[model samples]
Target: MIVAQAKPIEEILEMIDKYDKILLVGCKGCVAVCAAGGEKEVQFLASAIRTARKTQGREIEIREVTLERQCDPEYVEQIRGFAGDYQAILSIACGVGVQFMAEHYREIPALPGLNTSFMGGALEQGVWSERCQGCGNCVLHLTGGICPITRCSKSLLNGPCGGSSNGKCEVDPEVDCGWQLIIERLKALGEFESRFMEIVPIKDWSTSRDGGPRKIVREDMRQ
Candidate 1:
C-alpha cells in the first residue's frame, strides 16, 4: 500500500491562506489504513484550520468530506457538483490521489494535504517500514521471501554488506539486515545454496518511475 503522512498544520494553513473558502478532502484508502487522512482526520484538520483562521479573525469557510478513495476517477467525480462551491481543495490522500484530483478537476486549485511517504506496510502498532522500491523487477523468487533491494540499506543484491554484524544492519542497529533474513529463510527451506549461487544483476530502474509514461495494452480484451 502507498504510505503517507499528514502535512504540518502551518503548511496547510499557508496553502489555503489565499482562499476564503476551502474544501478539505480526505481519502479512506491508503490514508485511512495509516491513520493519517480519514473522516476523523478530516474533521480534526477542518477544526484546526478554522481555529487558526479565527485567531486572526480571517473567518475562513472550510468544509470537510471523506471519500472511499481519491485516486480513482469515479470517486473524484462524486465531488464534482460540490467542488465548484469552494475556492480550493486540499486532498488528504497519497500523491497519486492529489494528482488524480488535479487531473479530473482542472478548474479548481487542488493542493496536497499529505506527503506520500512510500510503498510500505505496518511494521507493528504504529511503525511503517518501506518494503518495496517498485524497481519494476521482482526478485522474490530467489533468496527466500526477503527483498534485498528494498530491505538492505545499501540495496545490495548479493549481500549483507561488510557493515552487517550479527544479522543486524550496520547502518542502523535497530533494523534487521535483509540479507541475513534471506539467508536464514533460504536455509530453512533447504535451498540456501540453490537460490543465491549466481550473483544478482544490477537493477534497471528505467521501468520504474520517470523512465517514461506507463501504458498497458490488453489485446485480447478489446471491445
Candidate 2:
C-alpha cells in the first residue's frame, strides 16, 4: 500500500493560518491503514489546530470529515457540496489525493497535511519498510520471489556486486545483499542452476514512468 507520514503541526498551521475556517479532510484508504490519516486522526488534528489558534487569541473554525477515498472521483465528489464553505482544505490523504482535490476544486486551496512516503508494507508491529518500486514489471519468479529491483541497492538485474561481503550489502552492513537472499533461496530449492544461470535482459523502463503518464482502459468494462 501507499505509505505516508503526517506533516508537522506547525507546518500545517502555517498553511492555513490566513484562513478563518478550514476543512480537515481525511482519507480512509491507505493512509488510514497506516495510521497517518483517518477519522480518528482528523479529529485529533482538528482539536490540535483549534487549541493552537485559541492560544494566540485568534478564533478559527475547523470541520473534520473522512472520505472513503480521496483519489476516486466518486468519493471526492461527495465533498463538492460543502467544500466551498471553507476557506481552505487541509487534506490528510496521500499526495495523489491532494493533487486530485486541487484539480477537482480549482478555486479552493488544497493543502497537503502528509508527506507521501513510499509503496511498502508493515514489517512488524509499528514498523513499515519499503518493498516495491512499482517498476511495471514482475521478476519475482526468477529471483526466488525476491525483487532485485526494489531490494538491491543498485537495482542490479544480475548482481551481488563486488561490494557485497558476508551476505551484506556494501551500501550498509546492516542491509543484507539482495542477491545473497535470492541465491540462498534458489539453492535451497535446487533451482539455482536453472534460474541463476539464465541471463536477464535489460529492463524496458518505457513501461514505467518513462512515458509521461500511464492509463489502463478496458473496452469490456466500457461495454
Candidate 3:
C-alpha cells in the first residue's frame, strides 16, 4: 500500500491561515490504513486547528469529510455539492489524492496535509518499511522472491556490492544486504545453484519513471 505521514501541524496551519472556512478531507484508502489520514484523524486535526486558532484570537470554521477514496473520480464528485462553501480544501490523503482533488475543484485551493512516503507494507504494529519501487519490472523469479531493487541500499541487480559485510549493508549496519537475503532464500529453496548462477540482464527502465508519468488503459474496461 502507499504509505504517508502527516505534515507538521505548524505547516498545515500556515497553509490555511488565510482562510476562515475550509474543507478538511480525509481518505479512507491507503492513508486511512496507515493511521495518517482517516475519519478519526480528521476529527482530531479539526479540533487541534480550532484550538490553535482560538488561542490566537481568531475564529475559523472547518467541515470534516472522509471519502471512500480521493483518487477515484466518483468519490471526488460526491463533494461537489458543498465544496463551494469552503474557502479552501485540505486533503490528508496521499499526493495523488491531493492532486485529484485539486484537479476536480479548480475554483478552490487543494492543499496536502500529508507527505507521501512510499509504497510499502506494515512490518509490525506501528512500523512500516518500504519494499518496492514500482520499477515496472519484476525480477523476483531470478532472486528468490527478494527484491534487489528496493531492499538493497544501492539497488544492485546482479549481486551485493563490496560494501556488504556480515550479511549487512555497509550503508547502514542495521540493514541486511539485499543480495545476501536473496542468496539465503535461494539456498533454502534448494535452487541456489540453478537460480543464483544465472545472471540478470541490465534492467529496462523505460517501463518505469524514465518515460515520465505512466498510465494504463484496458479496452475491456472502457465504456
Candidate 4:
C-alpha cells in the first residue's frame, strides 16, 4: 500500500489562509488504512482548523468528504456537483490523489495535506516499513522473497555488500541486511547452494524511474 504522513498543521493553515471556504477531501483507500487521511482524520483536521481560525478572529468554512478512492476518476467525479463552491480543495490522500483532484477541478487549487511516503506495508501497529520501489521489474523469483531493491539500504542486487556485519546493515545497525535475509531464506528453502551461485545480471534501468514516469496499458481491462 502507499504510505503517507500528514503535513504540519501550521503549513496546512498557511496554505489555506487566503481562502475563507475550502473543501477537505479524504481517501478511504491506502491513506485510510495508514491513519493519515481517512474519515476520522478529515473530521479531526476540520475541527482543528476551525479552532485555529476562530482563535485568530477569522472565520473559515470547510466541507469534509471522504471518497472511496481519490485515484479513481469515478470517485473523483462524485464531488463535481459542489466542488466549485469552495475556494480551494485540500486533499489528504497520496500525491497521486492530489494531482487527480487538481486535474479534475482546474479552476480550484488542489492542495496536498499529506506527504506521500512510499509503497510499503505495516510492520506492526502504528509502524509501517517500506518494502518495494515498484522498479517495474520483479526479482523475487531470482532472489528469495526478500526485496533487495528496497530492503537493502544501497539497493544492491547481489550483496551483503562488504559493509554488513552481524546480519545488520552497516548503513544503519537497526536494519537487517537485505542479502543476509535473502541468503537465510534461500537456505531454509534448500536452494542456497544452487540459486545463490547463479549471478543475477545487471538490472535494466529502463524499467525503473530512471527511464521516466511509467504507465501500463491492458487491453483486456479497458472498457
TM-score of each: 0.93, 0.93, 0.97, 0.97
lDDT per residue (tens digit) for residues 64-179 in model 1: 88999997888999998889999998999998888888898899989998999999999898899888888777888886878888899988888677988998998889999999
Candidate 3 residue lDDT tens string, 16-72: 989999999999999999999999999999999999999999999999999999999
CA-lDDT, candidates in order: 0.88, 0.91, 0.94, 0.95
Which is the better candidate, 2 or 4, if ranked by TM-score?
4
Give the TM-score comparing model 3 with the true structure, all chains together. Answer: 0.97
lDDT of candidate 4 over 1-223, digit per residue (tens) = 9999999999999999999999999999999999999999999999999999999999999999999999999999999999999999999999999999999999999999999999999989999999989999998986778899998988888667899899999988898999999999999998898888777788898989998999899999999
Off by over 4 Å in 2: none
| RMSD, one per candidate, in order | 1.7, 1.6, 1.0, 1.0
User: In lDDT terms, how accurate is model 3?
Assistant: 0.94
- For lDDT, the strongest prediction is 4
Candidate 4: residue pairs that collide: none
- Sorted by lDDT (best first), the order is 4, 3, 2, 1
* Worst 10 contiguous positions by lDDT, candidate 2: 206-215
Question: In candidate 2, which residue pairs clash?
Answer: none
* lDDT assessment of candidate 2: 0.91
- Please give the distance, in angstroms, between residue 30's alpha carbon in candidate 4 and its true position after superposition: 0.6
